[model samples]
Target: MGTATGSSFDTETLRRGVEGTTGNTLLSLYADDAQIRIIDRNTQPSHPKVLRGRGEIAAMLDDVYSRDMTHKLDRCVVQGDHAAYCESCEYGDGTRVLAESMITLRDGKIAEQILIQAWDE
Candidate 1:
């Protein structure tokens, strides 16, 4: 786990946060004024789903945490104040999803994140 340049961003912590996805762990990795943009089949590039602020992000994470799925982080890289990772999830219903995220850090927390996902249909 590497630190992002002068930032205090801990790659290990971020990895755990992403793999866990529980509200507490995940929320701890984000800044209060963080924003998340999601792009996928459900949320196309033309009309992406955006979550502004920690509250909305926490709520969205809570919903995800409640789901019966297994998450695995495949790869992660961090440089300067930026980090990127790929994760795969398999749900109880045998559905699988692959997600890649690019994030920007501020004060050791995620300030902005863009995520793209593809799921089995």
Candidate 2:
């Protein structure tokens, strides 16, 4: 792993952003022109659920955060201009989810991200 590029990508902020009910803090971590590609049982590698810009990202985050669930940031690794993290979530109805993400950073904010997640049936 490489050292940080002296940017402001703090893991503490990431923790609060992911675990908090509101998506405000999380949204702030993304660049204005950021993009996110999500893959899951529904969305495959050939066709990912892509989110362009903060507008689309915010919508997704809001929808996710509004759900009755608990989110935890399990682990994170950071290198030069890049990062990866694992997140675990459990819904009110006992459904569990695990997600892994790789992100590219620019000026301390996330410029691009690719995420793959799985949910318990």
Candidate 3:
């Protein structure tokens, strides 16, 4: 496992990972102990879905990337030990999903993240 010199998050890696077809690239950006909080229509903010550790996160990523869909990183900003990004995805049936994430970084890897998303229903 390699880390950056300080608290700098790597946006280039993020761009490469987000646009990739598989989850492997994006998974590499997370620390082993990372956690993610997801909020959507099915999961409200009052009781959001939380994924702990790389195992759960990886599973979720794989499932998402394996689907017949397209994902794009619309925007991203990184500062010191934090970052935020917007992601847009479209399914084969033309269902569109938009997600925005606020993230915390540790050792240049994603330590924790809270993502809110909405989908065409």
Q: Of the candidates numbered 1 and 2, which has the greater lDDT value?
A: 2
| Highest TM-score against the true fold, candidate | 2
How many backbone collisions does model 1 have? Answer: 0
lDDT of 1 by residue, 1-121 (tens): 5555466777776668767847677788888999999999989999999999989998998998899998888998887788899989999999999999999987678899999999999
Model 2, span 17-73: residue lDDT tens: 998989999999899999999999999999999999999999999899989999999
Give the TM-scores of the predictions, in the order they appear: 0.92, 0.95, 0.93
* lDDT of every model, 2 decimals: 0.86, 0.92, 0.90
User: Alpha-carbon error at 25 in model 2, in Å?
Assistant: 0.4
For every candidate in turn, the CA RMSD to the true structure comes to 1.4, 1.7, 2.7
Models sorted by lDDT, best on top = 2, 3, 1
Residues 36-84 of candidate 3 have per-residue lDDT tens digits of 9999999999999999999999999999999999999998877767889
Candidate 3: regions farther than 4 A off: 1-7
| Poorly placed runs, candidate 2 (over 4 Å) | 1-4
